[model samples]
Target: MIDFLNSIDTQLFLFLNGLHNAFFDPIMYWLSDKWIWVPMYVFMAYLIVKHYKMKGILIILTVGVVIALCDQTASHLIKHAVMRLRPSHEPSLVGLIHLSKAGPGGMYGFVSSHAANAFGLATFLYFVLDGRLRILKYWLFIWAILVSYSRIYNGVHYPGDVIVAAIIGTLIGWGMSKLFLYIENRRLKNK
Candidate 1:
C-alpha cells in the first residue's frame, strides 16, 4: 500500500512540477523562499496587535510556537524518521525534476517544512481571527495553498510530502488555538 501510494505521489509531483514555465519560475521560487514572506508576517503581526493590543503579544508568541512546532516536527522529527529522499534528490528522478535555484534543499523530504509552517500560520489565524476578520479566514488558506503548491512546483517535495505536512500543521494549529482559547476563558473567568 505504501509503495502504491508513493507511485501516485511521484506521478502527481511530476504533473504539478511539469506545469511550470519561465514566467512562474521566479515567482514560485520567491514564493517558496522563507525570507520573501517577511512583509506578510509583519502585516499579520500588525493585525494581531491592532486587534488585541497588549494581549496580542501572547497571541503572537503562540503563533511563534505554532510555527516552531510545525517546522521542527516536519523538518527534523518526521524527516529523519521517514528518510524519504526529495524528488529532486531521488536517484531515480535524475534529469526529470524542475528544481528552483534554491537547489535540492536538505537530504530527506517526507514532510515539507514550508508547507507545515505556512499551513500552521494560516490555520491558526483562521481560527483566531474568524469573525474578527472574515476575509482573513479565506485568504489565509489560499496563501497557504499557494505556498504549499510552490514546493511541488519547485520540485523539492512530492505531493504526499506537502499533503501530510498540511495535515500535521492544521492539527497543530487547531489544537493550539483551542488551548489558547481555553486559557483565555480561564483568565477571563478569574477576572
Candidate 2:
C-alpha cells in the first residue's frame, strides 16, 4: 500500500512539476524564495501594528516564535526522522524531474519547512485577525496554499510533503495562537 501510494505520489509530482513553462519558471522560483517575500512580510508587520496596536508587539513576537517552532519541527524533527529524498535528488528521478537553479534544497524533504512556515504564519495571522478583517483572511490562506504549491513546482518537495506540513503547521499555529490569546486575556482581566 505504501509503495502504491508512493508511486501515485511520484506520478502526481511529475504532472504538477511537468506543467512548468519558461515564462512561469522564474515566477515559481521567485515565489519559492524567502527573500523575495520581504515586502509581503513588511506589509504583514504593518497590518499587525496597525490592527493590534499595543498588543501588536506581543503578537509579532509570538509569530516569530511560532514560525521558528514550525520550521524546527518540520525540518529537524519530522524531515530528518522521515528521511525522504526530494524528487530532484531521487536517483530514479534524475532525468525525470525538472530542477531549477534554486536547487533541490536539503537532502530530505518529507515535511517542507517552507510550507510549514507559510501555513504557520497564515494560520496564526488568521486567528489573531480573522474577524477584524473579513476578506483578507481568505487571501492569507490563499497565500499559504500558493507557498505550499511553489515547493512542489520547485521540485524540492512532493505534494504529500506540503500537505502534511500544512496540517502540522495548522495545528501548531492554532495551538500557539490560542495559548497566546488565553494568556493575553488572563492578563487583561488581572489588570
Every model: Cα RMSD to truth: 0.9, 1.1
**Model 1 C-alpha lDDT per residue in residues 1-191, reported as the tens digit of each score:** 99999999999999999999999999999989889889988987888899888778888999999999999999889999999999988999999999999899988999999889988988887777648867767887998999999999999999999999999999999999998888988998999
TM-score of 1: 0.97
How far off is residue 175 in model 1, in Å? 0.2
The backbone clash count of each candidate, in order, is 0, 0
The residue ranges of model 2 lying beyond 4 angstroms of the native Cα positions read none
Q: List residue ranges in candidate 1 displaced over 4 A.
A: none
Kindly provide the TM-score of model 2 when superposed on the true structure, using C-alpha atoms.
0.96
The residue-by-residue lDDT of candidate 2 on 1-191, one tens digit each, is 98998998899999999998898889888988899889988887788789889898888899999999999999999988999999988999988777777987889999999999989988887887757765666787898898889889889899999999999999999999899889999999999
TM-score of every candidate relative to the true structure: 0.97, 0.96
